[model samples]
Target chain A: MNIKELHRQYKKRLAKEKRWIRFYQLLLLIGFFVLWETASSNRWIDPLIFSSPSRIFRLLMDMISDGTIFIHINYTLFETVLGFILGTLIGTILAAILWWFPTLSKILDPYLVVLNSMPKVALGPILIVALGPGMTSIITMGAIISVIISTIVIYTSFRNVDANYLKVLQTFNATKWQMFKEAILPASFPTIISTLKVNVGLSWVGVIVGEFLVSSQGLGYLIIYGFQVFNFNLVLMSLLIIAVFATLMYQLVEMLEKRLIKNE
Target chain B: MGFLIVENVSHTYFSKDAATEALQDISLTVEEGEFISFIGPSGCGKTTLLSIIAGLIRPTAGNVYIENQKVYGNKDLSIGYMLQQDYLFPWKTIEENITLGLRLLKQDVDRGIASKLLKDVGLPAVEKKYPRELSGGMRQRVALARTLAVDPKILLLDEPFSALDYQSKLKLEDLVFKMLKQYNKTAILVTHDIGEAIAMSDRIILFSPRPGRIHEIFEISEDIRRLTPFQARSHAGYSPLFQQIWKELERLEH
Candidate 1:
């Protein structure tokens, strides 16, 4: 066949394959909800614990009509974004400090390993008591959770940047600061963006656990409150909301990645 | 006095396991505008010697002098060092990469200078494009532009064209040779190619491997040195020098 005709057939096959995959994804989602609703209605499963999707949707509608869910979502969203930003910013700054002072990095090597291995969530209670059981403590929890890992990962990327690039800069009589700014930081951008993707999920875990402990506000608080009241529908709805927002945050990081590293 | 001098320079690399002597008692001198090449077998520390001369590393012994001033620990010296690969900053635009040295030096970053250097390297009107957008030969040309942008007094080229295809290598050789002569800049090239060494350099220093020491030096005849690299390869004196250097290199490898 002609080249144009063959190309058209190739594109048509690609479109068909994409449609089938998307159709299957939607089918799986709908099939899961249908199965859950049916099992609950038929008393085949413990509806009180599992909670049907319809029941959760009804609870969502009630929360929306009362205009109470917005506050929780807004509070959670603010804390999450602030935590993610602070975590990445502080982590990157710490990494830069480590890069600048190789001696210091070597000295802190054992300490960093210990801190990274230790559970950051275990420190949540102490943070709540120290900073008070407010948004400040929860935000600190979110920021603190991802900070150590981010520092380690980002610092490794900074170190792994091709030494030849620094050699080129050295020929120019570049200062250490210039070397960091021109080659080291720009070269590590891809790693930093990937870490951002990871931090989105980590910050969510931190904030939610903080809310579970504090039990005052946010989606995590809603889930804890639902559990206390035995309203599994509210818990499921809060979980679904968190899932959606986390994916959205991840997508936003991906967008920033595209904007930042255009050359790749 | 020579414009550049390497006097009794030796370097030994110490690690946890062992110490490797990379260069031993290496010394050389070059005039202001001369082109020199170091051709040798692998692991002969030609790159080590080049890095030493560039003042990026302090030799274990001896010193390098430029215009009678010490090289090591002198931050005022300007040297252009190129590697096998282009090594352009991938995140930066072509213009930004080329003008990087000037920006770092706190000099006036003139767009006209970047465009002019790009034009000189035969890559005009690509200021906004990233390094990844260019082909291999084009990226090397951009690298050359970046190196020459700072207008160093001496250029140390560590196999800058070795990564390119033969055709691109030939073209860049001619361009670089012509540009260096036109600017009257001193240059030191380290290469494994005997013919490249003969065609591009006025003097070829052959090095022996394992504790790299200068074994022999061949001075190209005045006639062949007058031609461009491509033409120099076709010149009558080129083959004899290439053959002689090839035999010497083969002997050194054993």
Candidate 2:
């Protein structure tokens, strides 16, 4: 075959492979729900704890009809997004500060290690006491969870940029600030985007745990309240909703990554 | 007095365990628009001397003067430096990279300048493309354009063509030589290649290693100097001069 015909065949094969992979993904998701429903209804698993997909879907319908699901989802989504933005922004700024002052980074190195190692969720109670048991405390919890790790990772990337790039700028008699702006920050973009992807998951964990502690409102509260009342369907419903939103947020970050790093 | 002067310059790099002298008592002078090359063995501190001359690094004891003024920490004098590798910012487009020095200096970035430099470097239509999109030689050409865009008073090229394949290296040497002559720009090249030094420079300074000092200087004959680098390489005097430098370099290495 000619090159054009061969290229056409290659594209066709790639499309077929993609279709099969997507088909399997869909099949797996459906098979999981079907098996869980069958097991619960057949009493192969304890229906009370296992809580079939149909039961969860019926519970979801009830919550949707009552319009109560949106409230919890909205609260969780807003807190997670704000917390994620604040965490990434604050961490990047902190990293820039550390980059600007090497002496400060050296001084804070041990403390950063300590703070990063300690369970940030464990600080929920203290945050609740200090910031009060409200959205403020919960958002702070989310922000705090990812900030230290982001600072450390981004700072490492900043430091690791090729020194030659700085040398080029220095030849032009560039100021320190210009070096950071033109070379260091832009060079560290790929790292920053990857850190954003990690922070998405981290912020969710923090917000959920904070809600569990606050015991006020959100998907985490729903899960906690469901466990107390023995409502397995409610817990399952909240879990499924969280999964969908988290994946959506991750996909959004992926989209942003593609846009920002178009040159590479 | 020459256009650029290095007077009794020496440098020592310090670490916790030891302080190593990298360059010692290096003094040289280049007349205006003179093309000079420093050829030497590795660790000869040719690059260190170039950095010192560019005021990127301070000499341990001595001074570099450009047009009767100290070069160290002097911002008014523009010095263009090109490295072994292209080192173009991957995120920046060719246009942005070329205008970077002007922007850094807070000068009004003239759009015409980028296009003009690109044309001069024979890379006219690649302004919007990133550095990664170009070939190695092409990227290096873009780097040259970027360096020249600021209209530096002196250019310090640290093994700029060493990374290229032979054909591209020869071609770039010709291009750089022609452009420097066309603009009447003063330039200093550091090279490990004796032939390249002879082909491109008016005067070649061969350096000795181990506390790095100048060993010898060779001046090109007037007949050989009139031609482009590629033509100069094919001239009768080229091989003899190359042989002499090669023998000097061999002796230094041993």
Q: Which one is best on lDDT?
A: 2
TM-score of chain B of 1: 0.98
Docking class of 2: high
The 10 consecutive residues of candidate 1 chain A with the worst lDDT sum are A209-218
Deviation from native of the Cα of residue A262 in model 1, angstroms: 1.6
Which segments of model 2 are wrong by more than 4 Å?
Answer: none
- Candidate 2 lDDT over B1-254, as tens digits, reads 89999999999999999999999898888998999999889999999999999999988999999999999999899999999999989888999998998998778888688888888888758888888989999999999998998889999999999999999999999999999999999999999888888889999999999889999999999999999889998999999888888898999999
DockQ of each: 0.91, 0.88
C-alpha local distance difference test of each model:
0.93, 0.94
What is the lDDT for A264 in model 1?
Answer: 83
Q: Which candidate is the best by DockQ?
A: 1
How far is B25's C-alpha from truth in model 2 (Å)?
1.1
DockQ of 2: 0.88
After the best TM-score superposition of candidate 2, give how far the Cα of residue B44 lies from its true spot, in angstroms: 0.9
